[model samples]
Target chain A: MMDVADLVERARRGHPRAVARLISLVEDASPELREVMAALAPHTGRARVIGLTGSPGVGKSTTTAMLVRALRGQGRRVGVLAVDPSSPFTGGALLGDRVRMQDHATDDGVFIRSMASRGHLGGLAWATPQALRVLDAAGCEVILVETVGVGQAEVDIAGLADTTLVLVAPGMGDSIQAAKAGILEIADVFVVNKADREGAQSTVRDLRNMVALATRDWKPAIVPTVAARNEGADDLVQALDKHQAWLEESGELQRRRLARVRDEIEAIALTSLRVDLRDDGRLDTLADRVLAGSLDPYTAADELLA
Target chain B: MMDVADLVERARRGHPRAVARLISLVEDASPELREVMAALAPHTGRARVIGLTGSPGVGKSTTTAMLVRALRGQGRRVGVLAVDPSSPFTGGALLGDRVRMQDHATDDGVFIRSMASRGHLGGLAWATPQALRVLDAAGCEVILVETVGVGQAEVDIAGLADTTLVLVAPGMGDSIQAAKAGILEIADVFVVNKADREGAQSTVRDLRNMVALATRDWKPAIVPTVAARNEGADDLVQALDKHQAWLEESGELQRRRLARVRDEIEAIALTSLRVDLRDDGRLDTLADRVLAGSLDPYTAADELLA
Candidate 1:
C-alpha cells in the first residue's frame, strides 16, 4: 500500500490515482491522513476554486461538465469536485455525478471526482476543500466545486469559491420565490440553464429585476444556456471570464482570496476541534450521560470541559 | 426584565408573552438564557411535535397552518414553529411566515412563532427542539415544526418530529427524483400537497411505489391534498391519526419519544460545549493562531482540550 505521504507527493506531481487516494484518506478522516494534508498545504493555493450551486434538477452537473470541457478545450487543466448527498441507509452516495461527466473520463486534461456530503452540515464534506487543495497542487488551473444545492449549504459553497454561479431553471413557479435568500446575492454570474424552456425569458426578466433590487455596486450579468446540449456554453464561459476580469481589475479578487484563506483556516480549526472531541473518551462519556437522563446535557458538557 | 425562572413559570401557566420571550432567549443563544431553558426543561415532553417538509412551493406553510387550525378545532391547544433561513446579510430573519397564518395569531388556542435558522447547518437548529420544549411545557398539545423545504434540514426536521409529513406538489418533475434519500426514510407520512395540480395522481403513484420498496415493517401512507382549499385535510389528519395509533398500538410512541429525549440531551450537551469553547477565551486564541499559521488548527484544538 502506498503511504499517505508518498501518495501526496505523487498527487502533487499530477498522478491521478494518487490524487484519488489522497481524497479518500481525507474523507475517511483517519488520523494518519493529517500528515499528508500538512505536507500538501505548502503546495496548494494555485488553482482557482469556483463553486456552482442551484436547486436540484437545475443541470448544475451538466453545467459543471460543460465548463470542464470548455476549459480543457482552451488548453487549461480543470478539476471538478461534485458533492452528492450521503445515503442514510447505505452511508454511500447514490449518484456519482462524476459519472455524468464520463465523456471526459479518459481526458488527461480533466479530473473529476464525486464526494459524498457524509452527513456534514455545511454543504461540502469536511474533506472537500482539502481534496480541492490536492487537485490545485496537482496542477489544475480551475477547480469547480458543485454542491447538492440546499439553501445554506449552497451559500457555504459560494463562500468557498472564488467565483460562484447560482444556476436556475425557468418555469419554477415564481422564480424569485424559488430562489432562496442570499443565493441571488452570492452569484458572480447567474445562469438561467435550460433556456430553451417556455418561461426562459421571463426567468431572465425576474432575475434581472431581483438582481437590480439587491445589488447597488457591481451588477452581475445573467447568462442563458442549454447546458445539456452545450448551447451558449462559450458565451457562459466568456461571462465567467468577464466576472473574473472584474474581480481582478476591481481588486476584489485579492479580497475574496483573502477571505477564502481566512475561512479555510477557520474550517481547519473547527475540524480539528471536532476530531479531538471525537477521539477523546470524555466526549463519549458525556454523550452517554446526555443520552441517559441522569445528567442535563448542558451541565454535563460544562463538566466535561471543567 | 423578567427573570428566567419566573418566565418559565409564567410560560408554563400559558402566558403568551412569557412563552414568546422564552423562545427568543433560547434562540439567541445568550449566556444569560441558558438558565431559562434549564428552568423550562422539566415541564417539557408533553407536546407531540410534527415536522412538515417538502420542496419549495409545496405549500408547507399553508399545510402547517391548516394543521394548526385542525388541531385547535379539536380543542387541543397548538403551537406553530416556522424555521426560516437567517438572512445572510443581516444575520437575522424577516419572520414573514407569521403573516401567512395571521388568522391564528390572535386565537388564544393557537400560538405561532418564526425562528431563524441562525446559521445552523441542519433544519433542527440547536435551539429549535429546546424552543419546542418551552411550548410543550407551556401546555401545547401538538407542536408543528415547519422548515424551509430543502433536503438535509428537512431530514433533520423529520428526525426531530414525532411524526413527519413529507409534502410534494403535483407536476414537479419526477416524484421519485424529488424524493431524496434522507427524506424517504424519515417521512412517517407522505403528503402530496397541491392535489389540484395536474400530476397529483402520478405523484401519489410514485410515492406508493417508493414506500413499497422500503423494507420497514410499517409502511408510510401517501395522502393527497390541496392545502390552500382545505380539501382532503381531514383524510390527511386521519392518516396522521392512524400512524399515531400504530405507534401507540406497537408501543413505539413511547420508545420513539424516549429516544428523542435522549438525542435532545446529547445535542444539548454538544451545543453547550460549543458555547463554552466560545465563551472561555479558548476559541479566540485558537482562531488567531490558526489564522496566523503559527499553529496547525488540529494541534491547537488538541491543546485546548488538554
Candidate 2:
C-alpha cells in the first residue's frame, strides 16, 4: 500500500499522479481514507469551489472547458472534476470530453479528472465531497465540478460548491426544465450558453423572468455566452467572481462552509456506520426479521439502533 | 386518530379517501405506518407496477393518460401516480398534469394522485414504494408511477417498477441522454412518443442501436407512439403486456418483487436507523470524537456500532 502521508505531500506539491491516486482512494472508499482525510484536513478550505451544472447536450463540457481556459489566462491553477455518466455511452462521451478540453492537457497549471459511477447506492454522491477536499489540499486555487443538473447525482453538488452556475441553451427547454427540476433554486448564476444560436435571447429572458420571481436576496444573474467559440466567457467568469464576493460579503460563504463541513462529517460517519452494520451482522438480523414479518422494520431498526 | 385496521379495510375495499389517507400517512412518515403496512401487506403483489419515466417535455402525463385508457378498454382498473416536481414551478405544472388527465379523474375505477417532494434527503425516493402498496391493496390491477426521468428522485423507481417504460421524443436528444444518464439500463421498454415529429425515426433507430449493444437477456422493445393523438398506444400496451408475460414466464417478476421487498425493508431500516442515530445521541458522540481528532470517522462509527 502506498503511504497516504507521502501521497498527500506529493499532491500538495501539485504532482498529477499523486493527485490521481488520492482521488482513486476517495472513489474506491479505500481503507486509508481516514488517514488521508486527516492528512488533507488542514490543507483544505482554500480553493474557490465552483459547480457548473446543466442537462446533457446543453454544452456543459464545452462551458466547463472555456471556464478553465479563462481562469488559466488569469494565471490561476485550476482543477476539474467531471461527473462522467457511468454508462455504455461514457466510453465515447468522456473521450470526447477529454479531447474537447485538450487545450489544458499540457498546461501545468490545469488538472482535469473524470469520475465514473461506482454503481453502489449513494456511492456516486459521496465521492465528490472528499475529492474536492483533495483538490483543495493540493493547492488548487479554483476547483470546478461539472455535472449534469438533471439527475439524482446532482443533489449533493450544491452542498460542495461555493458557487453554482446553471447552464442552459436556446430551444433546449433547459431554462424551464431547470426551474421545474428545482435546479433554479440552487443557481447562483445562470449562463445561457450557445448564445449565437437562435432563441438565446428568449432563453435569457425566461431565466431573468424566473429569477425575478425568486424571493432570495441574491438574485441570480443571467449571462449569455457562446461557449463553443469561447465568446463572452470572461463575463461568465466575472459573474461567478462577483457572486463569490457577494457570498463572502453577506457571510453566506462562511455559513455555507460550516454547513458543508457538517454535511461532510455526517456523510462520512453514515457511510462508516453502513460498513460496520454489514460486517457486524446486525443488518442481516434486522433485515431478516423484517422480511419474515416477525418484526416491523421500524421496530427492528429501533432495536438494532438501541 | 384514524384507526389503522379500519383504514386498511376501507383501502382494500377501494375507498378513494382511505387510499388517499394511507398515501398521506406514508408521505408524512406518520407513527402508524407500521400498522398500515402490516395490514396492507397481504393485499399487495397483485398490481402490475409500471414506471413511466422521461424528461419534462416528453409528454409523460399524456402517455400515461393514453395508457390508462387502453387498459380500461380491457376493463382493468388503473392507478396513476404523478411525481410532482414540488418546486414553485410545480404549482402550475401539477395543475396542468391533473387537467390533462382529467378524463380519468372522473372514472371510479381509476385513481390519479400527484405526489410532491417531501423536501428531505431521500424523501422523494422513499414515498413511492409505500404508495404503490396502498394502490395495490386498493385493488388497482395496474399502477403507473409517472416521474421525470432526471433528478435524484428517479433512482429507486426502477426498483419499484415491474416494467419501466422510458419515454423519448423527437429532438429531445433523449436516446443519447438516456444512455448517458444510465436510464436505458433500467428500461424494459422504450417508447418513442410523438412519432410523427421530426427526428422520431432517428431517435427510434438510436434506441435500437443502443439496445442491441446491451447484453441483457430481455431485449427492450422500441415502440413508437404519438401520445397526444392517441396513436400507436395499443402497440405500446401490447409491448408492455409482452414484457410482463416474459417476466412471469421467466420468473423474473417473482425475483424482482422479492428484491423490491428486500430494498424496501433495507431503506426503511436505514431511514429509521438514521433517525435514531441523531435522536438517541449516538451520532453526537461519534461526531464529537471524530471532530476532536481523537478518532477517525470509521473507528468512531465502529465504536458506536459496538
* Best-performing candidate as measured by DockQ: 2
lDDT of 2 by residue, B60-147 (tens): 8899999999999999989999876454323445667888998776688999898865464446555677788789879999999887
Query: How many steric overlaps are in each model, in order?
Result: 0, 3
**Any runs in candidate 2 off by more than 4 Å, and if so which?**
A85-95, A150-154, A171-174, A177-184, A197-206, A276-306, B84-95, B150-154, B170-174, B177-184, B197-213, B277-306
What's the i-RMS for candidate 2 in angstroms? 5.2
Error of 1 at A275 (Å): 5.8
Considering only chain B, report the TM-score of each candidate against the true chain B. Answer: 0.87, 0.91
In candidate 1 chain B, what residue range of length 10 has the lowest lDDT sum? B87-96
Compute fnat per model: 0.11, 0.15
Q: Candidate 2 recovers what fraction of true contacts?
A: 0.15
lDDT of 1 by residue, A1-306 (tens): 557777778888888888887777666666665577567655666788888877667888888888887898899999988766453321222264656888898988788887764545333435666677678879999999887653454336766788888888897634346343566668888899999999999889887887778744567779999998989889988988888888789888767765555445445555555545555567656545433434455675466546
Q: Write model 2 residue lDDT over A1-306, tens digit each, in one string.
A: 678788899999999989999999887777788788877766777888898877667798999988998998999999999875454323346667777888788887888998865464446556777788788878899999887543343345677789988788899764475355375668888888889889988888888778878888899988898888999888998999899999999999877776665555556656666555545556566655544546554565456656
